[model samples]
Target: MKVLMVEDDLALGDALGRVLQGRGFEVTRCADGVEALAMFRRRRPDVVLLDLSLPGMDGMEVLRLMRDGGSQVPVLVVTARSAVQDRVLGLNEGADDYLTKPFDIEELAARLKALVRRSHGAPELRCALLRVDEPTGAVFRGATPLDVSTRELALLKALLARPGQAVGKEDLHHAVFGDEPVGADAIEVLVHRLRKRIQGSGAQLVTLRGVGYLLIDEAMTEGPVAV
Candidate 1:
């Protein structure tokens, strides 16, 4: 999944980014709330890791604006503020989960997974005809079984969850490769192979020139080209 981490502390940001990336997340790190807001609008990450004490526009303000603008993406507030009122305020402002500083990265990952799962309105990992049991890394397409690697399943799950949206190449890269940057050709190769596998399954995977790929359901194929 893709995450936008809004943190002012460079050291902490780098550490969290590296750790989260290692744990299978596409992370975009922003040092301040303003930049976070801009990136959030552009990318619309699956989840947002926001810090309450941001420079210039505070994280609370950013969350308020995001809600006001009708963006319902899940947000997890990671901050040093541990007060009850502080946590209450952050929740009231639209954060799905809160994590205090010095938190375990594993716990953060688990919380994020829950938030993302809830945001997608699915009790489990499912998208249209595809269903994935994350714990066992099992996958099924409709009633037909398909054997897919863990990384490929991750890619498919991400794409299927946001069907019809043109997921950017960088975001996909982050989702699969995380901390390690992989070549664009690698992404292309994976998508190409995935397309070939799903070609006759009534799903259309279209490549947007100069942009990214879109996984479209058969019903949405006639809509405008995704970009």
Candidate 2:
């Protein structure tokens, strides 16, 4: 599962990121509320860990905007606000769970995992005009369906799983080919094929030198290789 953790505290963010990564969760950190909200829309993370006290905008406002914008992604409020009213307000505003600062790392991780599962497991993966219906292995461009081979569909699924973020070639290979043997540059071939399929999808394919590839709306991009 992917997590968007919005915390301005550098030390806490780094430590939690490391712990979550150890549990096989991909994590991205955002320091300020404004950036965090933008990234949330771009990344479509499985869960959000938000600090109530934030710069640019408060986390509460971010939560409000997300709900107002029709975002169904789960959010967990993690802040130092331990008062009863603070917890009540966060829940009322749409936080899936609340965790106070100086919390037990293990409990936090467990709660996050539960929230991920409670949010209906894997979310409906959609980015711009590209949408993947996991149940049917169907790919769509708006209301229309696109013809795609199994390999092509798998490649797109992996790429769009984490929209606007670079997905490594090795990860793509595993996602697409599994344990099957494949020649070098196999992933690039698949990427090229899929690129043609998604042309004019409102999102474009981007290569980050040696890092990997990501699909993003050129207009929505704030920077290269970042949502």
Candidate 3:
């Protein structure tokens, strides 16, 4: 799992980073709120560990920006502020969990895992015969893993995250291409590629014309199953 750790304390961040790495999590460290928010927007992480006090921008403002931008990635606030009002404010800003500073490392790991599991809902996401193993981020058809590129997998995960909804082209672009500069029809091209890749899985990549794209079970769109 990937974790974006936003902490300004050099020693603390290093120690926590090592611990998280030992627990098999890929951690990206950022010292300030600006850099953290930039990284968050460029690519989605499994979870975010945010500190309330940050330079460049405040952690609360970062939380607001994340929520306002419609990113549903779970965030856990870790700070020295243990007051009830502070906790309440963090939750109101869309943090899924909160842990004060000087917390147990083991408990922190447990909370992070729980947040990821809850955000993913089930271990597997399904549509027709296609599935994604949330724990592994692997796309599968029946018992076989589908051969797909990293970008393809990212796009698939994004669509599956909001199944049946027309995800805007802009959002898909950010999810797949990130900060890379691409042409106007870049998302369309990627969608076309993904559509062909999942063709055997009985899932359809549907375009919403002026809207964007969505995924659906082809079987569901077929009428009456021939009765």
Candidate 4:
């Protein structure tokens, strides 16, 4: 699993990252809120561990930004703010889970895994010949893995989130670009590129005009799936 740790303490971050790595997680550490937010958008980690007392931008503000921007990639607040109000605030602000500092590493790992599972509705997603390992960020076409970029990965993730049904372009836009400014037609471009890349994967990316896009496996494939 890809884990992003937004922590200011160098020693702690290093230790925790190593621990998570040992547990088979891909960890990326960031020291402050700005880096955390930027990395969250660009890297698209499966789960986030955020510290509330971050420099420049507080963790709460970062969480708010993520929510406002419509990124639902599971966030877990790990902070020294252990007060009841703090926990309440964090959950209210869209954190999937909360863990106080000085926590057990095992428990942290369990929480992260649980959050990821909940996000995907399971640990693995299978759509015909395409398979997505939610934790490892590995998308496979049968035994061969697909060469997908971060943006393309984000798009595929969104599509897989709802198999066999059309997903609105606005929602996908939020997932890929967040608050980043770009042309309104950007989602269409992404769909076009992703469609080409996913060809012969026994999966289809379908465009529903006046609606959005839908992805389906061969088993569910029927009719002309696009506009």
Best by lDDT: 3
lDDT of each: 0.78, 0.82, 0.83, 0.82
User: Model 2: clashing residue pairs?
Assistant: none
Best by TM-score: 1
lDDT computed for candidate 1: 0.78
lDDT of 4: 0.82
lDDT per residue for candidate 1 within 1-227, as digits (tens), equals 99999999999888888888877799998988889899999998999999989888999999999999999999999899999999999999988888888886655775687677777776565545666664334667777777876567657766765755788888787666655656758888888777766655656677888788877766545675442
TM-scores for every predicted model: 0.55, 0.54, 0.54, 0.54
| Candidate 3 Cα RMSD (Å) | 13.5
Candidate with the larger TM-score of 2 and 3: 3
Candidate 3 per-residue C-alpha lDDT over 1-227 given as tens digits, one digit per residue, 9 for 90 to 100: 89999999999999889878866789999999999999998868999999989999999999999999999999989999999999999999999888888986745765676578778774446788888765345679878889887778778877887877889998888767655688998888888888888978988888888888888887778552210
Q: Per-residue CA lDDT of candidate 2, range 31-149, in tens?
A: 99999999999999998989999999999999999999998888889999999999999999998888888886645765676577668865667778888765345788888898888
* Residue runs of model 1 more than 4 Å from their true location after superposition: 124-227
Summed backbone clashes in each candidate are 0, 0, 0, 0
Give the C-alpha lDDT of model 3.
0.83
For model 2, the superposed segments whose C-alpha errors exceed 4 Å read: 121-227
Q: With candidate 2 superimposed using the best TM-score fit, by how many Å does residue 25's alpha carbon deviate from the native? A: 0.9
